[model samples]
Target: MPFSFPTGAARFVAATACALALTSLVGCSNGEGGGGDSTTESATSPSKSGGTQVTINDFKFQPASLTVSPGAKVTVVNNDTTTHTLTASKGGSFDTGDIDPGKSATFTAPSKPGDFPYTCTIHPLMKGTLTVE
Candidate 1:
């Protein structure tokens, strides 16, 4: 038997396809850092037990971008010569305040997944982002 085409069904199918595409792009994995050495902010899923390392160097984030499961905990290690911070953007996932050089900060990833762009309070130009899966 052939499937009958309904007027609304086509729209629903199109919408579903679009949603899948968006989701795939949003959470596409590229290791701990999604930006891949772009000096941007990033998010990453902790090892089931939680806590992933993010290296801060040259006044910039090593991975620059990342994707992690919601509610995962992450740790940002300051490996540079300056202080840095990870301030959550709008989703209220996690934030690190004033991490000194050679130090590390930790935060819990938000339960809800979303795009979070953050910057260091001490330095506005220093920015990074996180894509919660």
Candidate 2:
């Protein structure tokens, strides 16, 4: 005898598999889908003299890495559903305290040129790097 599922079990399994495959495809499509890329940024323009914007979504910084002019103002926007912080790692420089959902904060870049690491104090796993030049 052959093994078989209940009346609707086979259909359900098929539908589930299809859904999972589609979800996987979407997640791998672009930087907007899933949180895979470690150095992704959503900034469409360069870090000008005014400021650069970084978006936080999906519990991760949209642009995980950025390069800006020295003393430039970096704006961090939290688009996620939870609060997050853009705190400098190892007490390097600036920290944006408790950025609520849909809110934003600004921090001035270091006057020197170097790589500065930052993370979310609330979610330590969320990390980012800022390069001042």
Candidate 3:
């Protein structure tokens, strides 16, 4: 028996197939509401925009959490290709409805001091926390 290497076209086909298979395996999903699969970004982490903004990208919250003073004007920027929202999960305290791709929305942080968890109404699995100080 003899062994031969794949030709250039054959190698290209194999590489492409592998690439596509990997892409599908890791494609982002607008997941259903569930336990957060994300980590809360510390209060000291760099802010997205002037310390009053959060970003939505790759089907996840950029910080996955935030801290701000009460009644702060927080901006939600949707950098993902799809629409998203940052909505309060508990008491409907805040919601940035249907932030389209490249669009932004602003909501006031609750006047009360506490931890307010939020999620994307469209993809609830994407969750975050907002701390009102």
> How accurate locally, in lDDT, is each candidate?
0.68, 0.76, 0.80
- lDDT, candidate 1, residue 23? 49
Q: Which runs of model 3 end up more than 4 angstroms from their true locations?
A: 1-38, 44-51
Best by TM-score: 3
lDDT of 2 by residue, 29-70 (tens): 224334554345524334444578778887677688888888
- Model 3, span 1-133: residue lDDT tens: 8987678999899888887787457545534344667344655243465558888877878777788898888888899767888999998999998999999999888999999989898776787889888
Worst 10 residues of 3 by lDDT: 38-47
Look at candidate 3 and give me any clashing residue pairs: none
TM-score of 3: 0.69
16 in model 1: Cα distance from truth in Å?
A: 60
RMSD of 2: 8.3
Please give the distance, in angstroms, between residue 49's alpha carbon in candidate 2 and its true position after superposition: 9.9
For candidate 1, write residues 46-127 as lDDT tens digits. Answer: 5334466667776666567778778767788888655778787665557888898889888877777787776676756666
Best of the two (1, 2) by lDDT:
2
